[model samples]
Target: MLPISYSSLNNSRVNRDGSSRYRRFIPEYFRRIFHYPQMDIEYTFWIMFYLCFNPSRVYKITYWHKQTKNQWARDDPAFVAICVFFMAIASMSYAIAFHYLSFFHIIKTIFWAVCVDFISLGLVVATVGWWVTNKFLRVSAHNHSVDQNVEWLYAFDIHCNSFFPLFIILYVIQFFLLPILLSSSFLSTFLSNSLYFIAFVYYYYITFLGYNALPFLQHTVAFLYPIILIFTFYVLGVVLNINFTISIMRFYFGQ
Candidate 1:
């Protein structure tokens, strides 16, 4: 016998013949948690957006079907278009959400934060990872699809004569662009640094459920070192035209 999960319940069920079954999650709980009207819209937007942009890597078989009709699986132009759209949304959301947070900081309620942690963080990490990993791993579709720790190609198909991966450039933008975008003074920079450290320590503490070395390293990178690197890269690399992103892309995609 298997233990039943409250999360999985059937309003209609048949035991022996398997006539029919109803599937549902605790809607009341979801409603209660996402009670805010704005959040309801945000949630719907992100979820729908996620469904569209999200890569379905394990559906190689689906690609088999799609291949007969057309090839939109691996390097699908639609997928790229969706990526661009979602990237724009993500960037816009980041800007708006951060701007809101920077000013008000009123939405940091416990329930909301928990929702952000579990829903947003987990989904993004898992889904993104899965999508990237599927390109190589041939892993099951059930695995984390979003945050497979796979490097994305900024310009995978946009190489000059020969396409090369350029995700490092994208990453650099995410990593460092926040600062310049804000036009921060020294004090604001200090506060941002402080928040970074706080977040790092908090992430470590939560990750291990109390203790571990990896968390310490994670904290350092997330908080202190990352800022230093971003700052340095923005100033030195940009000024010197080092363009590590381009070089890295060349090496990665062999262009």
Candidate 2:
């Protein structure tokens, strides 16, 4: 049975397709989080989505989620879809605003950018998960017979849920803030970098909560470990940017 908040959304009417007649988005999302908070993966996802739009409340969400005793490993597909949609919107905005790129070129650029961004972020997540599991997570004495591979997967799941807000904000800056400030070189770079730094610091705090929440992994000094991973992602992004620039030069200018 659904909770009162969820079940009452459509006045208790089932739709023709066997779905709820009413689609309660933000309200039910908030309701679930307020009621269940920690044990509900759906609540966690709803909280992530809320933070994506209202970034200032990230700290509160992180604190609340940390109090729950339940563990979650599944990825949120809805958040991914929202992010990809934003990426497409950003790409379309760039294409229309720039006007020099053809439709084919714009499509190609969007595809490549989205692929690289998603894959690079995934790599960072996987790397952090592996590192955390290897270095911090201890094996349960009760599960000594379990294979070692499961530990890393669990870490990945935790990382994904914890870092999702940061992921969404990064894209928001790239796709939304980048275009608006593209006209001014110095101002754009300064503002965008400032926003990114602020977002990263905030995200680091949230991740610290996740670290504390996990039963198998808890350390005071290692709280700053996420910053190192963030720097690694920055270095990877810089290298990719350099390679992309060289490829563009070679293709266009025959250099």
Candidate 3:
């Protein structure tokens, strides 16, 4: 018999249908979470940069990942970790910029922003995406012995990828425009809500791209349907003179 190489061993772990075994995947993912040195910060940053400028290229990488790794989801946690780090920093900056006096309030702001907004909401969105795709979008395995399902971790990865752009637009870019966005004028309200509109539309677009990249998935355009609802709300927000950015700030820091 020939020697068992590491590559063969790794390939053997993937199911014949090309889905990853979460039994092995979960522990490995979480284990790597604390191993900072092993994380590829450069690659993660590259993903974030392209996600903002050329998001389709980023999903192309996901396709390449499936070709090489036999799975559509990322095995690395570096992207998720870096995203949470950025979220925490943005939350802290907002707390300080808003002149939050109490340390408890500052910590609470960070907690809500990072834990609730990013992590909790991410989990919910990811779960829904995972279930919806697997239930309705996946190809039937009538001929094949086994069916492929969209991995939950991969769904969460898409959320992280999509959320990064939203975070940059709302948390980082919007922060710099606080002076104007916080003003009590129609122009300010329109601009601020427009920022939210753009951010959410980009989020859903990236999400659609992510699901579309999966060869086992069909009808991925359904992911973009939310944009229509978002646009309708944007029009309503503009008509109502609501500043989404200011409202979010008020919710966060009571400003």
Candidate 4:
């Protein structure tokens, strides 16, 4: 059965569709994380249209199927907002612990990496915030008229169409060109890029497929991501001796 929040919207069996790769084991997480915006717009309010023909009791069931299904549903914006709130709190805690407390000896290199990460995340939040605020501030009966075509309703359409291609081009330039430019021009190594990319792909794989490795792989990855940065910087420090500090500062600043 559907949750009460979505039941009124005419949801179907959560597992009726069989095409999802995670259907057999972890449908819930995959559904919640990846399904919502797409289903909300394109389907007939039929949540399970992507799954099996016959629906099961997604809310009441407590076994693997229901657990996974619930995990998926939690990706809805309603739940994500709560998760992000906690994540914000955690980020603040990290700042307090690393920047304020005189506890662990956070290498100067990792400290700068965290700053870069915070700045990037800050810009994402700011730009999205401005766009959303401006969008609503400009709303008018004529602009958002119910009678108008959706194409006209969402003038952001053309921008969306171009976003992916632009991202691809920039990524190609960054991935292929940035390294060459940085290595040859700036005389820097790509250590941070490599470590973070591993963490990213690992996180995505786990989010999509879950861990299929030995019992410790999940735990290892969970702990290794941050430690990887620390360890990488430590190695550089050992290799470069006294020059490591200056080089790392330059890399972080130039980045």
Candidate 5:
């Protein structure tokens, strides 16, 4: 008879069949996101969006880590690709609505946003994250093995999936929140800023949880990794000639 670990016992909810809980198909992932446990609240991809929005989700992630001891993050490429596509479409739509971008400009903008913002940035951060984890962290064998440590592509996929929730929020901001900010009314202005601030905090906080989702990295290191990557991505943005401010201003002023 084998002994059951406390962690395995707790994760029975997600790992009931001793299989990966991550979904790879976009349709299934989206479909599954809506169904939560009636009382306990199962964390699905869609639910992760709301959770990512809430600052309190950090505690949830921490608690989840404690309960499941499952730190290997989900690696869902289809979902990540869909999020990237939606973000590009939303930005392009916003630009077209304001008459700021031609179809050709839209194509270029989409390429830059998808290639630089999502794919390239995700790769850089994930690669760095994997290096850090492989070097410094004491990962669990159940989470990842030494052989898996060299699989930077797997790390990249995990980070890409992690970007899904943030991308969804960005889509909302691009399509709806920016328009609200454009409103000259006092209430709109207040609400827009407040929402943006909330989203900003939530994005970083969830990203912190994501870094921790890499097995065995200290929580503090997890918290700091995302902050550093934000700066790194900004630098990459400049190198790629992608100015988020200028793009938004173009949308705002229809320049």
Candidate 6:
């Protein structure tokens, strides 16, 4: 007979066969979304700040979370709510700075930024990440009495973590540098492409960190492979003198 740790016993009550509790995660997550008193806004902001300045530190917290809470994914919706709020604010700032004064245009920009870019794309990326890790990266079940699988919500949490830094770079920092980045010069083009390159590289690197932190996952380096493709595209963009920021602006606001 083996001693069962408190964490394991607690997890058994919630997870049972491993995934039943996660099936109810969405509804419960949404239910708590509007329950502002329960949301840890300050801690969520701390995670957001570290995500930009010291991303590995953010994932380290995730590891601690698993040990204490017996789950890899966050049960609180505060982070999601804050992310949506920030995305909306950034979109509005861009619209105002770009002189998109019409009410409909502002609403459209916010819709696309929040709904399409953040939420919809996040769903696709999270699903892909969740499937890939669970399908190919999980340790063999025979190795442990209880099989461990990456949670879908955890995968989405990784996406949210990765996207925050990217949002700061492309949305916040890029906005301040637009006067120079949008100029018609080779240096401007290089700088713009470099910003995108760094943003995407950090995105994938943080993503790799998220999965690598899991005790049951292996060969997490596969997540970093996208950086090679990103670098290739960066070189092509520079060779063609393509300013990615301006291109994105054109796509969003037709500037």
Q: How many backbone clashes does candidate 6 have?
A: 0
Candidate 2 local distance difference test against the native: 0.50
Off by over 4 Å in 3: 1-26, 142-146
Looking at candidate 3, the ten consecutive residues that score lowest on lDDT are: 15-24
Which structure among the candidates has the greatest lDDT?
6
Better of 2 and 5 by lDDT: 5
> Per-residue CA lDDT of candidate 2, range 15-76, in tens?
63344323343434333334433334565456666555654454444334434622233323
> Quick one: RMSD of model 2?
10.8
Model 5's TM-score against the true structure: 0.54
Instruction: Write candidate 4's Cα lDDT for 17-81 as tens digits.
Output: 43453566764533555555533333222322211221222212213432475221222332322
Per-candidate Cα RMSD to the true structure, in Å, reads 18.9, 10.8, 7.2, 19.7, 12.1, 8.8
Query: How many pairs in model 5 have backbone atoms within 3 A of each other, for residues 3 or more apart or on separate chains, i.e. clashes?
Result: 0
Between prediction 2 and prediction 3, which has the larger lDDT? Answer: 3
**lDDT of candidate 1 vs native?**
0.33
lDDT tens per residue, model 3, 1-255: 989998887777655435445545557778788899888889999999999999999998877787799888888899988888898888889888999758897788889988999999999999999999999999987785467889999999999999999999999999999999999899999999999999999999999999998878899999999999999999999999988988887877677
Instruction: List the candidate numbers ranked by lDDT, top first.
Output: 6, 3, 5, 2, 4, 1
> For candidate 2, which ten residues in a row score worst on lDDT?
241-250
What are the runs in model 4 whose C-alpha is more than 4 Å off?
1-139, 142-163, 178-180, 183-255
Regions of model 2 farther than 4 Å from truth: 1-45, 50-71, 139-164, 167-170, 173-180, 183-189, 220-223, 226-255
Question: What C-alpha lDDT, on a 0 to 100 scale, does residue 239 get in candidate 2?
Answer: 44
In candidate 6, list every pair of residues with a backbone clash: none
TM-scores of the models, in the order given: 0.23, 0.51, 0.88, 0.22, 0.54, 0.88
Candidate 2, clashing residue pairs?
none
The CA lDDT at 97 in model 4 is 38
lDDT of 1 by residue, 110-218 (tens): 2233344333554564454335334433323345442322223211211100100111123223335545433335443443343333333333322222111111112
